[model samples]
Target chain A: MSILIDEKTRLLVQGITGGEGSFHTQRCIEYGTKVVAGMTPGKGGAQVFGVPVFNTVESAVRETGANASIIFVPPSGAADSIMEAADAGIPLVVCITEGIPVMDMISVHSFLKGKPVRLIGPNCPGLISPGKCKVGIMAGEIHKQGNVGVVSRSGTLTYETVAQLTGLGIGQSTCVGIGGDPLLGTNFVDVLKLFQEDEETKAIVLIGEIGGTMEQDAAQFIKDKVNKLVISFIAGASAPPGRRMGHAGAIISGNTGKAQDKIEALSAAGAIIAPNPAEIGKTVKKSLKY
Target chain B: MKIHEYQAKALLSQYGIPVPSGDVAGTPAEAKKIAAGLQGKVAVKAQVYAGGRGKAGGIKLAANADEAEKSASGIIGARLVTHQTSARGAPVSHVLVEKVVEVRRELYLSIVIDNARKMPVMIASEAGGMDIEEVTLTSPEKILKAYIDPSAGWQDFEGRKLAYGMNLSAQQVKPAVKLMANLYKLFHEKDCSLAEINPLVITGDDSIMALDAKLNFDDSALFRHEDIRRLHDPAQDDPFEARANEMGIKNYIKLSGNIGCMVNGAGLAMAVLDLINYCGGNAANFLDIGTVNNTSAVISAFKVFTADPDVKAILVNIFGGMARADTIARGIIEAYQQIDIKVPVVVRLAGTNVAEGKRLLAESGINYIEAADFLDAARKAVDASKGGRN
Candidate 1:
């Protein structure tokens, strides 16, 4: 019933023997994600959380029939790991590693153009299809299986929004953190398209911050294509212009990518705007009621 | 990751793009020597990261070596505040002395990563000396863009088309095309986020030269380019920001506000600032503790915040998913143990192991006010910043 993932999703862990990879793999497995294989060069025979480790993604995929991969490789090797996964024919690759160079992403983005693969994030929290399968690192307890679909450019704010929805007895079909990097694999438009088509997703929540024209572009898509109820919130209303607010992508250059601009655009496109993060639950509830 | 104009020009020159003969000098005597060594009248340009240095009197013409020394002394020891920089301005540590070129035409050229297209784009305009963003708004036709596909590689024809579109004369066309290609190669080879030559000038002798250069490196890609990383000048950065970068804290920007904010993600960290302002308080700084919420990292985050004398109160908002609230709470306690924090503190913890996190904070005896939600926490922080009792 979920959009990108469900029970049939078989996961592969890249950089499985590393500190972040090994730790989050255990959490994902505990959350009931089918993590069948792990890949770490020079540690091929090792087992992390009972998952078999291989030296290469190609070997990991061939032996385990792993369809998806969540990469926890360090920033230096993340691009190579992603390309390896793509070369091995993994349909879905979620890069949880942060601090990847923009130039590296530019090359990766170019290489993935004609490929049959979808990359979620190079600096994102990854995606979770609640109660069915979790590919990346999100707190498992806060999610419940329902119809609401969430996509955000943030981590903790996404958690806050989902928690509010869960608190209001509203569960989600899938929640995706598209990452806070300037260049991302899957943007707001891509996720909105999926949410629009997924039968389980009757409502969608989009959390955007200052930076990029993605939110404006997403507003256009929502106006043209999306037929479902959408509740949105744009952060960084107080951020100064020309200053990068934590995220590389969260800077407002010139008159573009301002919070007010995004807010007005989304509002003009008929998307319900949550005044703040705490108001998302009520806004979504109200939108679904109408 | 932004290099000085001198450093950027050196990089451009290395790629076969012509630049005025210049050398960087840390002292006025050195600057005078560099100017004396040049063939003609020298221009003493203050080496700072911010733009609009010309308007800020950071750039001055010196007719002689003595005048060059005076210009260098006036600029090197002074802070050059421009519209692009903060009010305090960036301190000038060096002066770039170069042979002044004969007047001709000024045109704008830059290479940047376009996010929407997910590609490197070269932008050129006939009107180069003015702000390109302003030109893009007012006169869109004056600007020309060429999207570069790394896989397909850049073609010389694309450069020729851009050079022609920029209205360069036939004699300037070949050199302009070659310079464009070299700039693209340098941009791609160095993994630069932004490489610009504002006033990519046509001199009186009909020669093409980069009048001003600016290069911003991709911080993430610096691992592969250790040589590029070596060009980093900590003197150009704010002291707190520089210190934070040295300590492995990537996301820390000092702002002129009273409430110190420490949040997990960048988006939420900014949201925290907005919420603080919404509740009628200014955030003193933006500090994202990052994904690995360990005790040492938290301690470092607290140190960066408390180091700011303007931070009247502290707001710690952690919505844990991969970063657990318990881990953050432990870090907060550990930070309080090591540092003396006098500001009123308010904390809001939610999501994973939040109950345990709140309990840990309650037991720490640090006298922190716990709020039920985001709005309440913000209100409390704002109130605390005004010297209100928690």
Candidate 2:
């Protein structure tokens, strides 16, 4: 009943021979993700955690029928890996790599236009279907299968929210990190649309930070189309203007991209503001009760 | 990643863009010589990696070589404070002396990676020499924009169409087309995230020239361009940010606050800062440890925090799902032992081997506050900072 990924979703590991790729792939498999294939040039015929390896994404998809890919390639080659996955016609691509050159994403983003595939992140944590399947580097032990759908821009804060939810016996249906890059594959509005269509997702928890108009756009979409009870938390309340708050996209320029502006917009749009990351689960529960 | 105006103009000129004939000089004598070579009225521009230099007395007009030398003397070795740069001002290491041109009309033109559109976009405005964001917010219709095709490139026809749409003269359109082509080439070749010409001025003879330039390179692509590596202006950047980059820790920018943040990922570190602010606290700086496997990075992070006198408290938030918590815990312990920290530290450790990590922290006998969860940690950090302030 989870959205985007679940028990049936077949995953492919890009850069599977690398230290991060191999380590996370094993963890993902241990958490019950159906990792069917691994892709690393010149390492074709090798097996990582018993997963079949292929030289190219096309060959891997042809042999294993892997419809989704989790890429751990370095920033320099990340855009190429994303384009290759899109070309292979994979329905979903999650790029875990960070610090990708903006110019590289400019080309990759233009190429993905009019394509049916969805790109998740360049500097983001991958998605998880709670206890069913974990396709990212998020702590799987903190997640559980439940009715709440979680979507966020921050990684550790997502884990913190998930841990709090699990502590209160409120599990998530699906959690997606749209990433903190200025030009991300998915946006809050896109993931919200998916969560809105999923029947298992009763209430949603959205974790946002300072910078960009994505939060405002999400609030607008939530007001018009969202039927589920949604509680949100916008971070970087006291962030200084023109300063990038860790993430490339998290910069407060001029009057826009301020946390207060985003909080006000979301609050006016009928979203219960958590005010802090620690209150996300409790805030969602209160919204449900109301 | 932001380069000085002279560097940006040099890059633009290399791509065959029509930039004013100019040369950078490190001293007043060199400035006089460069101005003499131009053989006309010249503009002396102080070289600093920030915008709004024109308003800061950084830009001066010289009627002759002697005047140019005086202007360079006034600017060289002096800090220029612009609206963009802080009150402390940016020290001018060099001056760009260029031949002045007779201006007919000024128009704004730039190509930037539009995140919303997810493509390279061309922004053209009839109103030039002003901030583009203000133009976008006040009179968006005045800004004509077109998304470039990544594979097909920015064709001359597209540039000509934009010129005609913006009501440029027939002669000016030719140079505009050439400028657009060169701009796109420079953008791709230099791996620039942003390349802007604030006042693309049309001369009396109908020739177009870039009067001002600003360029931001992609930090991830620095390994490829050795020329850009040489242009790294550490004077224009925050010392903490530069030091963090050298240590492989993701740290940038410093803020005027009392609480310092140390977290595993960028997004999470931002969230922690936001949470601190939400709880009535201010973050001294934004720091992301970013997948640390070694203790040295942790020590570097500690050194960065301790170096800031305003940092009265520190918050450490890590979700070691990919990295083991015990490893991070050991790193933090090593960092604590290495540095003489005056601020109280609050630790919130989660994920794999978290219990062992917490146990190690407990055994270290360091006077640190431990929180069972993120909320408690934030509350403790904020309260401790407030207490210290009192």
DockQ of each: 0.76, 0.70
Clashes of 2: 1
- Estimated TM-score for each candidate: 0.97, 0.96
What is candidate 1's lDDT per residue for B222-297, written digit by digit as tens? 8889899999888888898888878788888888889988888887888888788878899988888876557788
Specify the CAPRI tier of model 1: medium
Question: Taking chain A by itself, what TM-score does each prediction score?
Answer: 0.99, 0.98
Please report, as a value between 0 and 1, the fraction of native contacts recovered by candidate 1: 0.84
For each candidate, what is the lDDT? 0.90, 0.86
> In candidate 2, what are the lDDT values of residues A20-100, reduced to their tens digit?
899999989999999999999999999999998999999999999998999999988999999999999999999999888
| Top-DockQ candidate index | 1
Q: Which candidate ranks first by TM-score, i.e. highest?
A: 1
Q: Candidate 2, residue B87: CA error in Å?
A: 2.0
